[model samples]
Target: MSILSLQGVVAGYGSAPILNGLDLALDEGDIGVIVGPNGAGKSTTLKAVFGLLAVSDGCILLRGEDIANRPTESHAGRGLAFVPQEHNVFRTLSVQENLDMGAYVRRGERAALLDRVFEIFPPLKAKRAQPAGELSGGQRQMVAVGRALMSDPSVLLLDEPTAGLSPLYMSELFDRVVAVNRTGVTVALVEQNARQALGIATRGFVLAGGRMRFTGTGAELLADPDVARSFLGG
Candidate 1:
């Protein structure tokens, strides 16, 4: 069964719609990558799923339940977490403190969750006392992701996690994404690095004009001549 499904979804910021009845489904333990041009509604899709935008039509199903119009705060407890592309962390807060904030909605012990987060992003462990603003871009990204993990979400929505990083950091971030997925969290990510993002994806979606133009396995999309020429820069 699909863990998350978007059926004929239409969403937008105001009256102008970005997603035009888009459809997508992601099974459990899948790393789904969305890649497309700048205005293709890639980020909008994540926003819709996270309930940050208004959906005028259709529904977003999480674990077979309709969660289309729910508020953003309501998502975390339902096993959904989202990390936006920028300004994701509390710059003034310490690393540990930032993670603690992520767990504010939880009523259970957070120590184990913190340990797991540190294990996933080991660099965070050594700098637990440092301010998030002081970390490098990649480490800050880790903190952002780690903060989301503190909520113990079953599905993670990442909007361009590798947005402003050096090539080395981008590669390392992808590796960390895979590591996170390996631990059974379903991942849906939007990325500008088409080739690299699709390289690690279990399922790849190519969007154009706010609609999916192509959908396939990562290897299948990578191997397609048309997909390579149009989206992967040949």
Candidate 2:
């Protein structure tokens, strides 16, 4: 069964819907990438699923249970985690403290999870005591992702993870994303770097005008002449 599925999801800031009858699905352990032009509802999809926006219509299912219109906190408690594109971390908090905050909803010890987060992002281990704002853009992004991972989520939603990083850092971040997914967490990412994101994705989705234009394996989308010409910049 799919870990998360969106059926006819219609959502937006107010009443003007951004996601027009959007449908998406992801199985456990799959790295799914959503790529499209600006205003195509790539980030909107994640926001809707994360409950950052109200769903005006349709349902969002987590393991087949309807979670549409549920609060964001409730979704987190249900093993769903989201790392948004910006302002994702507490700038003044220490790296370790930021991670600790991510586990606020959990009821048990989180030492092991903390250790694992540091393991996944080794740079964080060395700067655990430093404020998140003192870190470079890439390291801060790592902190944001590590913070979300502290919750030990079953599904992770990332929006524009590599938005403003240098090429080297962008590549490194993608490697870390792959590393995170290797631990059996399903990842659904909305990325601006289409080709690079799709290269690492198990599945790729192309959205246009808030609707799915193409869906296939990453390799298939990369190799298709039409997809390449239109969305992949030829």
Candidate 3:
């Protein structure tokens, strides 16, 4: 089952378009990774789905409901969570506090949600009272992802979850993403690290110039000559 779908979605900044007729989908329990060059609108696709930009024309369906142009809360209420690459956590707040914020939409069930987040990110449980900003880069990323998981979202959208971290950290972060998927949350990853991203993705969509150049299983994309040469750094 597809948890999220974007059909002919068009969105951009003022007076300029970034995602042009972008089409994609994320099936339940599938880790879908989107990759391309710097200007390929990878982040924009996530932003559009999160309702951060104006989607001029197209339909964004969340579990078969039209979510295009819906306010952020509407998306959040339906168990859709977004964890952007930067500033994903509340720096001034402790790990527990940040996790608390992710469940703002879910009233009267806070205890269970907090416990669930800690289960997914064990480091967060140990440093529950420590400020999020003081953590190492990799740990902070864990907190960011943990916060998103607190919301009980079935679909999690991540933008460059391993942008600046070292190779070891990057590997660890992707490991967590796989763990999250194992627990049944569909993941949509927007990443610039094409080779690494495709390696773990069940389905890969290679975007170029705001359009999808290739959409196939991860192994298929890895084996394709054009995808390897153009985006996979062959």
Candidate 4:
């Protein structure tokens, strides 16, 4: 069964709707990528699922349980984590401090949790004492993702994780994401680099105008000429 599923979900800003009956499903241990142009409601989908936006219609389930309209704080303990594209890290805090915040909900085993995150982001381990704002963009992104992982979530929701970074860092970022997936975490990611994102994804979801344009395996969508011409920059 899917770890996360959205069915006919409708949401918007104060009644000005953005998502119109969109549907998506993410399975356990799968890397699902959502890609489309700007205003395609890519980030909005993550927000809606994370309870940042009101759900005007439809259902969002976590392992078959309705999570629609739940509070953001209520989600953390339920094995859900979200890393937004911008302002993801606590700039004022040190690297280690930001990660520590992620584990506040989990009172015990804090030491082991820190070790797990540091292992994944070695650079973060080296710069644990440095202020998060002093780090480069890519490092900050790593901290953002690492903080989310600190919660030990079952399903991770990433919003434009590779938004702005050098190609080197971007490649490394995706590698870490894949590594995380390998360890049994389900991932739903929003990305602008459709080619690279879809390349690693087990499943691809093409969002356009707040609705899904296509749903299939990564290879299948990449092979589709129409998908290539439109979303793949052909």
Q: Where does model 4 exceed 4 Å of error?
A: none
Q: Write the per-residue lDDT of candidate 3 for residues 1-234, one digit (tens) a residue.
A: 578999999999997999999999888889999999999999999999999998999999999998988998787779899998887888999988888888787757789878777777888899999999999899999988987887788899999999899999999888889989888899999988778888899999998889999999988998999888988778
**Per-model lDDT:** 0.94, 0.93, 0.89, 0.92
What C-alpha lDDT does candidate 2 achieve relative to the native structure? 0.93
Better of 1 and 3 by lDDT: 1
Provide the lDDT at 81 for model 1. Answer: 98
Ranking by lDDT: 1, 2, 4, 3
Best by lDDT: 1
Candidate 3 Cα RMSD (Å): 1.2
lDDT of 1 by residue, 1-234 (tens): 899999999998789999999999999999999998889999999999999998999999999999988998899989999999999999999999999999987748698889889889999999999999999999999999999999989999999999989999999999999999988899999999999999999999999887889999999999999999998999
TM-score for each prediction? 0.98, 0.98, 0.96, 0.98
lDDT per residue, candidate 4, 1-234, as tens digits?
888999999998997889999999998888999998899889999999999999999999999999999998999999999999999999999998999999987759688878888877889999999999999999999999888888889999999999889999999999999988876889999999999989999999999999999989999999999999998999
**Pairs of colliding residues, candidate 2:** none
lDDT of 1 at 169: 94
RMSD of 2: 0.8
C-alpha displacement of 193 in model 3, angstroms? 1.7
